[model samples]
Target: MMEVKSKGQQVSRREEILDKAARLFKQKGYVATTMREIAEQVGMEAASMYNHIRGKEELLEEICARVAETYVNQMNEIESSDLSPIHKLQALIRSHISITTKNIHWISVANNEWRHLPDSSLKSFKKARDTYEDRLAEIIRSGIDCQEVADVHVSITLYTILSSLRWIETWYKPNKSYNARDLEENIVNILMNGLKKSG
Candidate 1:
């Protein structure tokens, strides 16, 4: 029992460290953040920090991988759903807003700092990102074929929607006049209006 409790505590502490590291990485780019700074933020000494995490690169790789996996999984589910192309796009937008709002720091770090990942991890991350975009583009293409979406360029449409969603991390604040749900609905309405085929 005591051994199990110790292991649980260690896991909790490691997660706490990762959270702090993510916020720091968001505030001060991954290249600018130091392990000692992360240690201080988590109220641990630099040496003790090493006991839980190997180094800054490890923390970064974990954070980036976790967020990327989440997006890829969500995309897979949305792509496989029986919803129409328009609805699939709406669902995808909602998923992005939901993930960004709930894990702002992690999302920000992943978006802004992923380029700093080591060679192999960087390659993997890019592949996942490209695959995600390709899947999204396919949805738009299907929508166009069905005449559910306007005949816009798939890459342009994909990036336009993505760029708007990605900017949420810059200005989004909780407890503001607008909430996540409200933001999601408004964005969906606006983007959908633009994409929906007109007479």
Candidate 2:
């Protein structure tokens, strides 16, 4: 029982360290953040941090990998669903917003600091990102074929939507008046209106 409790506390401490590292990485770029700073934020001795995590790169890899996995899994589910092309796009938008708002710090770090990941982790992150984008593009292509979306360039449409969504972390705040649901609805309405085929 004592051993289990010790293990649980270690896991909890590791999570706290990761959370602090993510916040610092979001505020200060990953390249700018140091392992000692992360330890200080988590109220741990600098030398003791290694008991919980390997190093700063490990923190970054975990953050990026978790966020990438979330997006890829959500995209897979959205793509496989029986929803219409337009509806699939809407669901995709909602899922993106939901994940972003819920994991704001992690998402921010993952988006802006992932380029600093070690080479192998960098490659894995890019592959997952590409898979997500390709699946989204396929949905857009389906929409165009069904005449539910305008005949715009698929790459342009995909990038436009993704770029817009990606920028939300820059201005969005949980304590702000503009809540996630409102943001989601407004974004969905705006982007959908632009993509929908007109008479």
Candidate 3:
């Protein structure tokens, strides 16, 4: 008979591996963080990791997928709400920026480490990521039509908004002074007002 572990134990082990790998990736980067090193961090043999995942690349994909999937689902939920286009746009952007800060490493993994994956993995990852971006772009397009967001190139505006927030991962640190909500407010203000305050 097969041995059975409780679901909580399985989930905890998975989270342990994911969390340790993420920290290693963030600290040592993708190229430098070897599977052996990651395994050792969690007191397992490097080969034993294959029991949980195919390879290091898949782990990176999983980390990125978690954030991307969360954003896509959040976008879908926001879109279904009864709010006006302006409110929807504002609320979604706020939530999106907050999420970026919450899972800041996703930005680095998405932009930096994802390219090192195999072609098949890359394709799957790109599809999920692009679909998420397209949803955001669709919302931006809606905002433009409704005059909630300014009249600008839809792709450019969306990219600009997202790129600015994604760049935060490089320098952002969770602290008492500023936080995800503060970043969201700043982004909304920049979208609404120019650098020069009106008299």
Candidate 4:
């Protein structure tokens, strides 16, 4: 029992460190952030921090991998669901907003700082990112096939939607005027239905 508790505490401390490191990476960038600064953010001495993590690069890699895997897993689920193409797109958009809102710092770090990852990890992360985008493009292609979505350039459509979704980390704030659900619904409506009013 005591051993299990010790392990749990270690895990908790590691996560705490990751959380602070993610925020700092987003703000100052992965190249600019140091392990000592991360330790300071987490209220630990710089030397003692080595006991919890190998170094700063490990933190960035962990964050980028975690965020990328989450997106890939969610896309896999949406792809396998029984919903029609349009509905699947809606679900995907909603999930994107929800996850971005909940993990904005980590997502921001993943988006901006992933390039700093070591060679092998960088290759893997790029592959994961590309795969996720390809999955989204496939869904849009299916929608176009069924005449459910406009027959615009598939690559252009994917980029537009993804770029918009990715920017949420830059500007979104949890304030009284809007919330995650509201943002999700609005994005889905505009992306799915367009701005033209129907008679």
Best by lDDT: 1
Which residue pairs overlap in candidate 3's backbone? none
lDDT of 4 by residue, 1-199 (tens): 1010113435678888988998999999888888888988989899988898899889888888888878887888889999988778878888888878888898899988888999999999999998998889998888878877777788988898888787799999988699887888888888878512233
TM-scores of the models, in the given order?
A: 0.92, 0.92, 0.81, 0.90
Candidate number with the higher TM-score (3 or 4):
4
> In candidate 2, which residue pairs get closer than 3 Å at backbone N, Cα or C atoms, i.e. clash?
none
At residue 80, candidate 3 shows an lDDT of 95
- For each candidate in the order shown, give its overall lDDT on alpha carbons: 0.88, 0.87, 0.71, 0.83
Writing each residue's lDDT as its tens digit, candidate 1 over 1-199 gives 1010113435688888889999999998889889989999999899998899899999999998888888988888888999999889988988888889888888899899988999999999999999999999999999999999999999999999999898788789988999988988899889999999999
* Ranked by TM-score, top first: 1, 2, 4, 3
- The clash number for model 3 is 0
TM-score of 1: 0.92
Error of 3 at 125 (Å): 1.9
Q: How high is the lDDT of residue 65 in model 3?
A: 64
- Report the CA-based lDDT of candidate 4 relative to the real structure: 0.83
Q: What value of lDDT does candidate 1 attain over all alpha carbons?
A: 0.88
Worst 10 residues of 2 by lDDT: 1-10
Identify the leading candidate in terms of TM-score: 1
CA lDDT, candidate 3, residue 26: 80
